[model samples]
Target: MRLRYTTLVVDDYDAAITFFVDVLGFELVEDSPATTSTTGAAKRWVVVRPPGADTGLLLARADGERQRAAVGDQFAGRVGHFLEVDDAAAEYERLVALGVEFEGPPRVEAYGTVAVFRDVAGNRWDLLSGP
Candidate 1:
């Protein structure tokens, strides 16, 4: 079976949304409502998908204690997920030009040219070019 969607926990909902939509050019597939608990605090859960791709992203909440701990561990140099692109170098350059900072330039790996970058919330993601 083909792969489906992947979720990435992010701290700032609006910032993450803008980064994916404005910088990376992903479109919003689903705009989840702001959920609330008995305390009446609103929560956010947004999802976006890459252009021309059926697989969507689940922008999970990253506020509660559990989410905060999870996100902290991930941002502390743990890879949460990767996104495969047609040309890693080209995409890397494009994102860099868009003001998206990369930890380092792209390098050739066993699979292909791969680069790592942090989202607004310090979430690490690898841009990979499949072999």
Candidate 2:
């Protein structure tokens, strides 16, 4: 078996969807009906992925105060997610053009080219190019 999806908590579905789909160029894999219980707010099982990635992200909107508090702080204000791309510089430029919030300037290291950026929800992610 293989891992399928990881979750990213957000404030709203459509806003999150737009960022990943429009800004990041992720493919919309699925947006279907979902229910947490018999009596609760309606929800959607939203998932998205890169053009050719096996793993996808489950965009889970915050359902309550607890989950809402977790939004943007999922990574504890650290660069916990690394999005490996073909070219960090190119992607960086595109994201900048789209007005994506980046932590700082891209820097080259022995491991690879990497730049820190914040997702729509404020979680930090590193865009890296290397092994």
Candidate 3:
């Protein structure tokens, strides 16, 4: 079976949404309902999909203490996921022009050229292109 969707927990939902949508060219599909309580304040979820791509991402709230801690430990200075692209260098350049910052330049690897970048909330992602 094919994979459906992947979820990422971020501290700032709007910034994360903006980065994925504006910088990476992903399309927004949904925005979470506004939260009322202090504990839930700024808590929201967003969904986005890559341009012309069926698979998508779910931007979830990193609100709960347990979840926030878990996300911090799991994704700390690490890529949340790796996305395959037609040309890693081209895509990296395009994203850089859109104000996206790269942790390292694209480099050739055994399977492809891989470049690391951060989302708005400092979540890492890898852009890959097969050699």
Candidate 3: list runs displaced more than 4 Å: 32-45, 70-73
Candidate 3 scores a C-alpha RMSD against the true structure in Å of: 3.2
lDDT of 2 by residue, 34-101 (tens): 88774567899999998999999999989888999999999788886789999998999999999999
Instruction: Pick the winner on TM-score between candidates 1 and 2.
Output: 2
lDDT of 1 by residue, 73-114 (tens): 565687666878999999999999999878899999888889
Query: In candidate 3, what are the lDDT values of residues 1-131, reduced to their tens digit?
Result: 77667877777778778888888878998886877476556556578998787778877777678767755345767777787889999999898888887888899989989999877766678999998
TM-score of each: 0.80, 0.95, 0.78
TM-score of 1: 0.80
Worst 10 residues of 1 by lDDT: 72-81
The best-first sequence of candidates by TM-score reads 2, 1, 3
Cα lDDT of candidate 2 equals: 0.91
Residue pair clashes in candidate 1: none
The global C-alpha lDDT for each of the candidates, from Candidate 1 onward, is: 0.80, 0.91, 0.79
Better of 1 and 3 by TM-score: 1
